[model samples]
Target: MNFNIEPISTQIEEALQQKIDTKTKPLGSLGKLETIALKIGKIQDTLSPALNKPAILVCAADHGITQEGISPFPQEVTFQMVMNFLGGGAAINVFTQQNNIELVLADTGVNFDFEKHPSLLDYKIAKGTKNFASEAAMTIAQCEQAMQNGAAITEKLHANGTNIIGFGEMGIGNTTAAAALLTAYTNIDAKDAAGAGTGLDEKGIAHKAEVIAKAIAKQGIPNSPLEILATYGGFEIATICGAMLKAAELKMIVMVDGFIVTAAFLAASKINVTIADYALFCHKSNEKGHALMLDHLNAEPILDLGMRLGEGTGNAVAYPVIKSAVQFLNNMSSFADAGVATEK
Candidate 1:
């Protein structure tokens, strides 16, 4: 389908200058907002960037490695957490509602069977992926299907006029899986990428790293992101990666969530460099490897409230700043129009 990165337009730069001049504050007074508005304007290729019909798509799945005791939470937590999201009790739900964002929960690979939960979108690939510690986590076909699911979801959201989309994940032990994927993709030591997922203890963290190292050593590094993803990635991570790419193709602003979602974005960016331009990093997560990962990607997070809870919390919390960026650009009037003296 010729997925290529679109270049920022000069019109966006000109519009940004005009918009900033219109605000009560001096031009470029709002440092980050100016940058953000310009970036958004460039992304939408419009002088007027509007974040209409914003949606947070949370992909949920269960990691087979949860059985290995890598995470403090149980695998069942994946479905339970999805239920929590459906119940509108999650941090994501609260923030999404506050921001008037539509929330979508996709069952990518959660193990439990759900009986038609109205709020839940049933796109389950399987009960869950197989154990990667012993073998490949998902087959190539499974990986492809997950990607398609993600693309379809993004396409649906885009068709519904979703201008800004946030990516979140719900899965037990996903950070462990994401860390392992990062270690393999970046060729760093798994120990360095490992984190205290769901509050793992020292011993548990060590064991998790050891297990990841062993798995990576056995599988060997793959030639591409697809192969690597098929080998170690949870369905939720894989889906998020696909969503990032699709969002970029559709020219939508992609707000990345915490560590795992960032990892997914990294994987997608590796496959396509233009993906980085479309992504707005939400925050630097408290996950152990998130800061280093962000540094490696050369990404500046929009906020740093020390958020660690996944489920798109960072993206949701950072919505106000995004809203302000759009609001300032669209609603503010120019100095000449306001009869204000321009500081020459």
Candidate 2:
């Protein structure tokens, strides 16, 4: 729980900027790639930085609010998708494979009892969270335990020399929980926070909004990030929050996926404002309120492919771009080395 995350130092900014500017190209020809290079350099505290052992941790869980019929998909889909992920049939699997990013899956609190697989991590805090529509989604102890499990996973990866970690989540009806958490943290209206999750129709979205509003009324506003998480967060979301905090504490590059993952980051940022300093917002999800959430964080996503699928697909797709950024920084020649004349 004690991440002890520190703010990214600015002392190296001048040196990093100079190195980037001296590249054998126009001052700003690389655009966002240049910014990314500078960021990685600062994160590594070196003029030349390298990305190694890139991995994405996908956390799976089930939401008790699925009982409220917020999503068009059945609760069974949560488990089914976990199976899909294991079977290499999911989008995340394909993208991670295509990009050569290691994919790690965790069963934080899926309702089903999964048979052990070599690739799947077993850290189920419970079968699933309690119905937040009726009460707190998770007990305080469960939330804390979920977060600790997340931190432990990140610690293991960091110890193994994995310095760039991305987070993704899978949980049926989790968007309802995400909406409620967003409303609580940002005071965004319930209707605005609600979205057509998993192909919900307008009427279903309306009803989902009503359910979220009622849950908010019942739980009232939470006093802190921990309280909000315990009151409305899914197991996967809470775990992602803990993982993100640990990644930032370790000064690793944290690649964040879509809506649900962003909700986790929102909570993590509230707990430790410096977490965002080490984060890379991968893309803008088409899901409702996602753009607003990115704006809230003042984050510029690397892509806007209208992607809303979770399970770290965005991070996997964007990993090559992140790698390219680091590559140019370490390999590209300076103007003098390239025998290029400066613009007169």
Candidate 3:
């Protein structure tokens, strides 16, 4: 997918105000939902910004370092969550169903073997990525391939009239991986990036930080973001970065999920700074590193319910607010037509 710079436009903001004043409710009564509508309108360049064919792309993979017990959950949990996603039992499933959003699954680098499920997209890069402590987590070629897989998915969505796209991830030990990447990319100490991923204990958190520090030390090379990702990133993270780049190139409104998703965006933004203009942070994850990451990105998230269950749950939760925004903008009438007072 092309990663060309996208020019920002303000035409839709004018249309947004016209619709907001016409709503039956007093102006600005809806608070954030109104902001959301205006934001979508501006991105889509329409007064009536509809999220027709909204899609959640859930990318799943496994981190080889789960063997080191940095995460409280076992490695098998990765496969279990994938099953939950497929069975419609997960939070993302319910939210998408409620919002009528389409869902797609990409096996970016999971270790488990599975038959063809109707929703699963087979784009596996390897059985799983290598443990970053041992060597580079993925070769540069693998990183590019994962990115291409993400771009391919977006191309299909763009053609199918998907106006908005949100990204989610499923992988054990990934938060640890994200923390490491953030430390490298943002120049934060490994301790700052290290968090209670999957409820790690005091000792586990310390171990996570120490191990990440060692990984960084061992890397020994200049801290380029792409090199950091290729050295220590998860397959899913690479794919998500690719998706963000492609989404910007396509000029589609991007709904960015939590910390890990932001880590991917951070990596991609290093490659092309313009992608940030097309992104809407869905919510802040409760993961410890998330707020710091958002601060670095200067992102104002749509929700802040202290959620951290990475399967795009935050994105799903934020969808209604987006829908309400579009609904108000489309259904509200002009003040002149409604016989309401204008800003005379």
Candidate 4:
């Protein structure tokens, strides 16, 4: 469980800024792109930073909360969507293919078993988490296993020279778990954290909120990240937390997806605050609690396409923008190199 993530040093910030400012453009005109370039440079600890073998890891699982009828989609949909991801039919598949980002799928804890597939990593920790309404979502052992598996996956990718990763998840009723985690981490009311996930209607969302509230009351407020995750997190969430921490430890660019992925990062940040240093929030999801969650982290997302669908689609969609940021920093000519007159 020891991530060993270290804070990114600020020693290079000034130098990075100088290099960016010398670009043949009005200072700060590039806005957030400039910020992203600086961040990538800081992460790589170099003036010239490159994204290598960028890939998106979509971890799918089932939630015990799904049995409580939180989502309009059936629990079977979780496994079905995993199949879609494998079949290259999901939105994430389309976007990743469109952008040429490698797609990695993991069965962290889906309810169904599958035949061996080359693209799917079989790291199933359990069929699914236990119902938090009646018991802890996952035993401590399961939580640790899921996290370790996630970290191991990232380590393998890093070994393969993959320096940038996007984290995403699939789980029926996962929003309930995310709401519970958000409430625990930010003290946001369960009602506010609850959202219309997977086409939940108003009544379903209200019921979801009540379910989360009861789970919180039963579990009491968790004192630590591990405790919170064990109490309310889905297998995919725990795994993403581990992946994110390991990515930071390896100084990889972590492109975080929407609400559920962000919730995992919230827990990871609590465990090791430096994880945020390696993360680039890809977009502000249209999910109700997402904006609040982003505000909680003081994160500014690069896109606002009103996207709420998961499966790492947001990360894949935003990859070009992120790449552009790094490209302009490393490839754009400086005023001196371009023979452009500096403002007097």
Query: Candidate 2: which stretches are off by over 4 Å?
Result: none
Score residue 249 of candidate 3 by CA lDDT: 86
Error of 1 at 169 (Å): 0.8
Clashing pairs in 4: none
Lowest-sum lDDT 10-residue window in model 3: 219-228
Better of 1 and 2 by lDDT: 2
For model 4 the TM-score comes to 0.98
Q: Which candidate, 2 or 3, would have the higher TM-score against the true structure?
A: 2
lDDT value for candidate 3? Answer: 0.85
Estimate the Cα RMSD of every predicted model relative to the unseen true structure.
Answer: 1.7, 0.8, 2.0, 0.9
Question: lDDT per prediction?
Answer: 0.86, 0.92, 0.85, 0.92
Segments of candidate 3 deviating more than 4 angstroms: 11-29, 221-223, 342-344
Give a tens-digit lDDT track for model 2, residues 1-344: 67898878799999999999999998999999999989888888889898989999999999999888788888999999999999999999999899888899999999998988998999999988999989999988899999999999999999999999999999998888888888889999989999987888999999999998999898898787899999999999999999999999999999989999999999999999999889999999999989889999999999999888888989999999999999998899999999989877
All candidates: TM-score? 0.95, 0.98, 0.93, 0.98
lDDT of 3 by residue, 1-344 (tens): 34786765686567667677567677788888777777777777776667778898999999987766788888888888898889989988998898888988888998999789988888999988888877888998998899988988998999999878999999999998899888888888888899998898888899999988888898754556677788889999999999878887888888999989989988888888888778888899989899999999998999999899988888888988777778777876666767877556
